[model samples]
Target: WLLFLGITLFQIPRIASQFKEENWHRISETIPVSEGTMLLTLDTQAEDPDFNEVSLKIEGTADSLVTLEKEFFSRGKTKAESLENAKVLGYQVSVLDSLVSFPPGFDYSAMDVFRDQKVNLILKVPYEKPFLMDRSLLDILRNTIYRNGYKSRDVREKNIWAFNEAGLVCLTCGSTTDETENQDPNEDQTEEEQINREKLDSLSRAKFRQRLDSIE
Candidate 1:
């Protein structure tokens, strides 16, 4: 006797279309994430955490990558297999060049083995209201690689994701960049002039506040 099992895989186009519809609000806004949006929550107290004192974890894995650090001209990179043991706001990241040694029994010629597989970076930031700026961090990483004359697809890949409380997860890829162009000629003023202006503004504000406090 022979038995046959029917299998159906979800359609990618449908999934993508549904996602766009669901996130239309975010996609339409010039600045979807507000300035005060919580990017990461640094809790100093958590029991039996991987880092023991602090742990860094993201809400999703879409922002995870395995990439080379040198290719990015980045100085911050460290090896990490689990966010459970990472420090919150940690700068030590993992790079691809350093991960040449895979675990034993793992075949490098596997079908899903992305040639640039090692050039991936995974960052787990705490869940915050704004998680990050309006733009994703992956864009920034890609731009940096491109600016350095390195083909992003050939070099390393960077992923920045966020995680929130209640064990919810979300992932994203690429970095973000400000699209705003300065219209004010003063925008390019000398650093000294800008510093002086800021100092004067602070002094004036301080005087006004002091006068108001006295009346109260």
Candidate 2:
């Protein structure tokens, strides 16, 4: 009996180290607006390489101008202890007239255990009102936009949009009209373009040489 007890005690810490718990954290806010469009921006940044995923869902609702729901999952040694630790990492939502912003809630860089975490944001806005989104969020939802026969070069710095019965669309292209107008749609390359390309290549080589020199 004494030998068995000693073995069990030795295994207790090993078993406990593998224990994991998932915690859910959420925030909801309502913005008041009578008429006009609202702009929603999502700012997400994670320093930890283990930070796995961040998912966002935006839908239209007649009930509110802006509503945000965030879920956080945290894993640790015990369920109760994990949840208590997660509560320390809080987020904030801000509203200013017709604009709503969401910034990274917790300072994960300051804490070590908070490295393994995932955040999901769900935003609901008025259906009829027009809104603009930041490029960061748009990049995450790019799969939802249709891309058939569209080359990466064609849309690299251009605005992307979708049109259908639902009338969902991307607001504007990244490039300005003057920039687009200056380019020739013809297949033949211009002399000025050739010169500019060569200059860029030379600059790139110089930068590469500097990096290698620094390493040596």
Candidate 3:
């Protein structure tokens, strides 16, 4: 390695130009959306740091297909060489049934040299489709607006949200970012609660008077 480094120093200008990043390749794929699925969960955990960085974006689409897009970059003497180098793909997507276990980043450990390879996942779905975002997706979800003025990360993980024309919206009470429109837990009364309230109110006159006298 040292000998190669020393040899390259003799022709720094020519060698450096040979390794300049000059080309990028793009790819896009679409998949059909499954039926009867309402909830989508994102895996919060990230993959190994050594791998190339991958970014994710999700949006509501009138169309029923989910799209995955990627851009791979490489340094080469010619455009064809760069294209051929970037053609080596190694990432995988895991979207089975309801539970999502996909890795959060792209894997590039097997590849030689550093190629500015990037992957962008575009999950398209109908409006009002519910989802649970992991805290890790904050970087990708910031652009998305939620019902009211709540930030995407501000909503709790347990809370479910609907991705609609309006953006990310809280579907449940606990998931709301603000106190507005919050209903009181005691506002609704059941038969047992009514009976309990009546019992407390209908104290005997003598006992009520005695209690009042004691307080006085």
Query: Which one is best on lDDT?
Result: 3
Off by over 4 Å in 3: 1-15, 18-21, 31-47, 139-152, 173-216
All candidates: TM-score: 0.19, 0.50, 0.59
Tell me the whole-model lDDT of each prediction, alpha carbons only.
0.26, 0.50, 0.54
Question: Taking the tens digit of each residue's C-alpha lDDT, what string does model 1 give over 175-200?
Answer: 22233221122444577855554454
Better of 1 and 3 by lDDT: 3
C-alpha RMSD of candidate 3:
16.5
- Candidate 2 per-residue lDDT, tens place, 50-95, comes to 3444556665565644666766666677777666555555555566
What ranges in model 2 sit over 4 Å off? 1-19, 32-34, 42-54, 109-112, 139-216
lDDT of 1 at 28: 11
lDDT of 3 at 46: 57
TM-score attained by model 2: 0.50
Ranking by lDDT: 3, 2, 1
- The candidate that wins on TM-score is 3
On a 0 to 100 scale, what is the lDDT of residue 210 in model 3? 59
